[model samples]
Target chain A: MAELVFLKLGGSLITDKRRQETARREVITRSAQEIAAALAATPGLRLLVGHGSGSFGHFAAHRYHVRQGNLEDWRGYAETAAAAQRLNRLVTDALLAAGVPAISVQPSASAEAHDGVLQTMAVTPIRTLLDRGVVPLIYGDVALDDVRGCTIISTEQIMALLVAALRPRRIIMAGEVEGVYTADPQRTPTAERIPAIGPHNYAQVEALLTTAFGVDVTGGMLDKVRTLYGLVTQHRGLSARIISGRPPGAIERALRDPSAPLGTLISGDGAAASPAVGGR
Target chain B: MAELVFLKLGGSLITDKRRQETARREVITRSAQEIAAALAATPGLRLLVGHGSGSFGHFAAHRYHVRQGNLEDWRGYAETAAAAQRLNRLVTDALLAAGVPAISVQPSASAEAHDGVLQTMAVTPIRTLLDRGVVPLIYGDVALDDVRGCTIISTEQIMALLVAALRPRRIIMAGEVEGVYTADPQRTPTAERIPAIGPHNYAQVEALLTTAFGVDVTGGMLDKVRTLYGLVTQHRGLSARIISGRPPGAIERALRDPSAPLGTLISGDGAAASPAVGGR
Candidate 1:
């Protein structure tokens, strides 16, 4: 087995989050193709994939505040989980069609939480899947919470759980936008992509993200960055790249060679001298 | 909601267990229709349904002895789970098409065992689903075990877990044969159907089950009786019926009226004097 890599296909990139239960089939298929190509290029590159529920689950989660937990409404918890699993079936079927040998490891089934914080998850199935060279695909879903009754767990938080168990070398996030920007790129015309963010510059970047106007619209992205930043900072030699999956072959390029340099690279102690090439 | 009912669709009833991944789609569809009709007829019945993996999971499980647990063979664990989930998809899809609001509650995802003894399971989802008038469909699958690494949990055991959490009035098990017989009905021409078995006659019934020739061929059926016997003995007023599902309207008839008396009734102590009409 080679160095392990964790790849996240962001919900916004794979589905139309603004709509209800709408999946961007082309995007999912293309991403699957890119992943298949990457594996073909590097046969020994161990990978674990997670996807977000996007419109499928987020609507119900937000409407019912499942993330905050709802003891009174068990329907909300079940609906959230069912919707997310519906999308997971789509994504995993596409991966299998592309010969990725993808199997779903539903987060809601194995994950338990206390006050919205993930506590225990069955990681043996996942670790064993990776060990046997099978791509275990996980997704965001509802989890049982001791305090809240039931809560929603995001793909990043699930990844964080996996990270604690299986220390991967690189984390690749494929989303709609290119990478983390100095400002909200959609609103600000002068927003520049931050090429490299390390321990030394993380505080500075955090400040920019906090003060940036219209960042609230992309609040999910901000949360993702914060989660990834915390992960990279905690584990040395662990790096994360937030890259765009829109352009053709970008994901394939990034995955085939870890140093392909097409996204915002966040690292810990090492790789401070990485070049500031704009993620286009 | 009215009185709750736990229904188990035996693997041998729904799928060709001897074959690999073969599903009797007609049986499943008809069963779904019967359930839908029954629920429609009795509007207030709260139901929780469970199905066996049949050919889907049993093949791999038996091949690798997954029920016995194997620490070195993780592939077997995954394969077993995947196979079972595939069958669940088919069953759930059929139920949905038949106008049944069936949502799969995968047992392996939430179930844990210590040396094959089911310890902690997240029963909130199933309980809540029943409370909210939604049918939660659970199936037998691979579960992580503390001492053995991984093992398979059957639908009967899963029901036993549910029986402890939510005490339903009755349990209906659908299988290929009608019910418990005085001998191996398949091999013995003189085998007579046992109308009912309770604490009063349990010793005699066990003697018949054990001394019967060719009973080992139906070993799974024997296990089912033993598990159900344990459950009924522990929880009074809760009776179980083992009936054949081949007849078009047996399930619908049984579900519509709790006292329909179509199968062998295994009761604790309350129903010992019930009529001894043989289960046809």
Candidate 2:
């Protein structure tokens, strides 16, 4: 069997986060192409693709307060789920159009959350797809929660769950930024990119990370980092890398070789971290 | 709490079955309006809408032979699923546009089958939606089967499972034809519609029923009657009606009054059957 890899296309990369229900078609197409190329190059490469709800789902989820499970009525639940599926269709379509055999696996239907935490997830269907050389595409969705009635789950959180079950070789988070930085690269011109993060230096970088704004009901960058950090801690050999998807070949490079200086690697060992990059 | 009703919008009624991927937009719009009107007329009415895959899914499923679980390759699984979701989006969009709070509850995502028989179904989310007064729209699609790798499940089959769980007051099967005819209406001009079918003459009518052809992978009319017959027999008080959706108020009438002289009613007791309708 080929090594398994989990790849997440950040919602911001595939959709115009500034515009509601707007998909960045060209960007998604290119990303799918790159991922397809990576698969062709890597023999026996098994992959699972997940994406954030981005603008499509966030606006509706936020309006309905689905994350807080404050659904005043059932419309909130219906609209929230519908909005997420809308984005899921776009992502899956783009992937399929790009010659990737991507099938959508709706989390709301098969998975349940408890107090915003995933309690049960059916990964058997996903495993079947993977075993047959097909890629299962999942996204951030409004899920039924045992404790809160319903909650918005992030792609990163879903990926974390899948990693535990599938035991993927590694996880690649393709976002807008190249890697983790000491400060917001847009706001802090002098902010330097971090090479890696681990137990030893995670604390210093954790404080520097900023949360995202806009329609995202799920927590932003900081939350993603925290989730990955938690996963890496539990699984000894598991590692994750956050890299920019904008630049050509960035995702492919990260997937083909995670050790390359393309992104910030989060792992159990601190050996990959460069202290000189950023430490406050 | 209002009585729950299961409504199925036949794929043939909503889509041009002869053409692949073609949705009969006007038909869907009309059906949605009728359903909305029915809800308006019936106070405390809770409904679950299910639709057939029609053109969008049938062609791919037929090509892949998904119904027989004859998946020579995995691409069939992905393509078949993707095709079904495409149609589901169209159906949900129509319902939402008609001002109906319809949410797509994917069967493949939540339900599993064992050799074409439903093994487990996660319906808590659907129940939550219904409790909150939102209509959960589901459809026919490919599902994971314990015995077979995967199998195609029909809208009626999903409804059958829901009927067992939710114990809906009645099931409304909206289709292209008026109801179960004594013989193939198109082929047998002398064939007349059967008003009702029950244990008394079910065996005779079952022998007269013919399966549908064209793009549908699921066994058509005969399969629908068989499934409904089983459900009606198991649930003493629960009943089902197969009615034509092409007429203006067929669905509304069926939902408003199952005994309305508009379609064939299948109940526990054979009170409405007219033997003179079809036997040659």
Candidate 3:
């Protein structure tokens, strides 16, 4: 494989989370185009694309309390999977229109969990797709649980597993906002976008992170940041970027140049500049 | 819940099996309409729909010999799944247009196998969908295997599991031919359709049955008949039908009246009136 990359299009960036099952087609189309462009520019790029369910799935999961694993609420689990696939279909369709060979790999079909923790997730299909130079599209969806009956699996969780199985060079997360901020940027006018977080400034950055806003069943922004932090720590020569998907050419730029310095970079080696480190 | 039924649209009936990746859209649309009409007529009907991969997936599986579990052929598994989903999308689209709330429950994601034998398949989603009065569409696809790494699960295999779990009343299989014949109906002019197969004539019928024709990774017609026979025998009072889908109202009739007698019937008890038993 050439240089493997895992790109995640955050739920909030592609779909309106406040509403139910509403997709922001334009944003998705643009993201697809950017991905296609990125691949064209870097033909050697082996990419695995994943997206969050957003408004398309969270409501069903929330309404049914699926995460709680109510044995009587299998309908909730079924609907949640259905809702997620509806959104996935739209995303895949957009990618196809943009000339990307995107194939949906439903997490529920191949993922098995034990009491809300994913124990077995088949990675053969994903690995095979990348080997054939076809972009494998995966997303947050339902998975069968041994103890609870069934539960939801998030995109980040799926990505984390992929990272371990296939040591991608870097992970790029495109979200509505630019990057990690000192506070919830939407609410805090004085919140500053953290340039980079490393071992030197880990405590400082952890203290400033806030819970994600809106209807997210999966633990929000804080959990996401922590997941990324843990991944980079565990894997050497690995780094991650949380960048804004709003500005035109932002995703393409990040894909073309891994060290574009456009967003908050999380690293384990502390090689990435940590401005707050000197003060600490 | 109201009376439950499992309807399988055979691959040969809804796709050009001889060709690659070809789907019989008109047949699918018509089948969907017939299904919708049947549901409309009998408001108490609970239906679970399943379709075969046909040309959409079998070729890839055959080409890759996915059934044999070549660890080096993960791309084959991935492509087989993609091909199956592509056909599934078309089938679901037709159902949606015909006013059916059809949601695809991928067997690959939730089914686990031990040496090509399906050991565990989550039925909660299918059961829940029926409980909500929504049609859950399932299809044969790639599933993770404990022994083979990964293998294909056929529609009949899935239906068998569902029958054991939910205990549906009857299974209606729509195929290109009228029903089980003494010989390959397409090739043998003297082939005779067995009106009913029961314990009284199982051995005789089994001896005369022929294999299915076309690109099917899963064992063809003979295996399908044996599965149905086994299912009926295992679950007393449950009966099954293998009828031709080319006839406009065949599926509808089978759905509306379980004993309409338009095709070959397989039953555990001999009450189905086996014509071939008198001589024996």
Candidate 4:
């Protein structure tokens, strides 16, 4: 089997969450270049890219109350789905321009959630493309639900499901912040970064991490940690690293070597000791 | 089971094929209105709309040589797929504006082809949406092929596959011309229009029909007839009608009455007599 990696580009990294439908073009282009460099360094590496909806999807979904399901009018569903696709297009285009063969795969078309939990996902098409050395790009979107009629599915949720099916070597979560911190680093001067986490220390770290501030329909850092925690605990061999994409070489480093002292690492064994008071 | 119809809006009808990437917005809006009116006239009607790639897809697919497959460069695949999605967005937007509740279900994300033959398609999501009374809008797109690497799959091919799964009440092919004529209507004034075609008279009528003119990556009229002929013949109960979308009430009439004397009908049994052409 080829070495596969699942990477999530947090919406905050690629788009301006403060403004509706505002894409951070320069940041996205730089990130794509970094990803391309990583692929060049690692031979036979297959990647599955998923990005958060950011402002593009969240604003429209919120305006229409799309996540509530069973709306008096179904037009909101169409609008929400379109907005997500628009963002996916922008992300895929940047990757393509940066020499990555990124193909857009909308989740709503092939995924279903029953009461906010993904029940069935057709991943064969994605698998075939990945085997052929093509990058399959996915994103958060509105999906049909058996119990709720229709609901919003987050990128992290979709990635967790994909990790189970594809069994990627490692998952790299890239965002604006360096990693999970003891508290909101921006607000608290005494806060410190947590370098490593596992089932043993997950609850302790979870209590310290703060939810991201902005217009995010999907729960921010807390939801991401919760989803990754479940996957890492269940799949002993799998681990996920959370890193800041803003730095020059953070993404490549996290992808190339997960245990590097650059960012926080979450695993099943909890073998690595926490590095203290790292300078940002 | 509610009544379902598989309606295909030919790219030539909704777009200016002579000009690359130019969508005929006016025509699309008019067609949507006709479809909406029909849905209002008949209660409990469900629809699955599939449109051709038109200028948007054909131009990129041709430029990239995507259909030939096994190309040295893979970037063409991403380009081609992006082009198709652009057109699908425009179409879905028009349907939503007309209050049709159209949702885009991208074929490339959940569909695979083996040597240009569709191997697997995750149609369950679409089925669920249709069950909830939402129109699942699909389009011709670039698909990964096991044998050829990647190939372009036409809207008719996708719709034919859906017919087997959904077993819609009828299939309507809306295009620029009124119907399949005995000869090139523009060149041959004496040519007559064939009202009905079946297994018995298909070969004779097929030889007389002319292929559509333009830059269509997928073969035009001849290809449509061959696909529908195979489908209608084997299914026995299934029938497809070719009609002009330009005329007022033509699409609504065709959807409501497949055997109506408006266009060419391909059926298992030859019931309607072939109508001779008097004038256009």
TM-score for chain B of each model, two decimals:
0.95, 0.90, 0.93, 0.91
Candidate 4 per-residue lDDT over residues B1-280, each given as its tens digit: 3678899999989889889889988888888988888887877688999999888888878888888775566788888898788778788878878878888999888888888877778788889888877889999999888778888988988988888888886788999887877766777798678777776778876665533333243246777788888888777567778888989788887766545677777777543343321111
Tell me the tens digit of each residue's lDDT in model 2 across A1-280.
4878899999888888888999888888889888888888887889999998889888888888888887566567777788888888887887887778888988877777989988777788888778878898989888877777788888887888888788986788898887777766777788788778888778877766643322243246777788888988888777888889999888887777656677788887553554422212
Compare the candidates by TM-score and give the number of the best one.
2
Q: lDDT values of the candidates?
A: 0.81, 0.80, 0.81, 0.80
Global Cα lDDT for candidate 1: 0.81
User: Is candidate 1 or 2 superior in DockQ?
Assistant: 2
Off by over 4 Å in 3: A1-6, A12-48, A54-83, A86-103, A108-136, A142-154, A157-171, A181-192, A198-240, A245-262, A266-280, B70-73, B146-149, B184-190, B210-219, B274-280
Error of 1 at A139 (Å): 0.8
Write one digit per residue (lDDT tens) for candidate 1, span A19-123: 999999999999999998998888789899999888999898888888888766655665677788779888877887787867688776557788988887778
The model with the greatest DockQ is 4
The TM-score obtained by model 1 is 0.81
TM for candidate 2 is: 0.92
Question: A1-280 in candidate 3: lDDT tens per residue?
Answer: 4899889999999999999999999999999999999999998898889999999888989998887786775556656776788788788878877877676777765677789887767676567657667788999987767777767888888889889998998889998889877766777798788878879887777665533343343247678788999999999878888889999999988888777877788888775764422111
| Candidate order (DockQ) | 4, 2, 1, 3
Q: Name the regions of candidate 2 deviating beyond 4 angstroms.
A: A210-219, A270-280, B210-219, B270-280
Q: State the lDDT of candidate 4 residue by residue for A1-280, as single tens digits.
A: 3588899999888889989989998888888888888888887688999998888888878887788885566778888888788778778888988889889988888888888887767788788778877899999899998888888998888888888788887788999888877767887787688777876678777665534333253246777777787888887677788889998888877666556776677777554443421212
Which 10 consecutive residues of model 1 chain B have the lowest summed lDDT?
Answer: B271-280
Instruction: Quote the RMSD, in angstroms, for model 2.
Output: 4.0
- The 10-residue segment of model 2 chain B with minimum total lDDT is B271-280
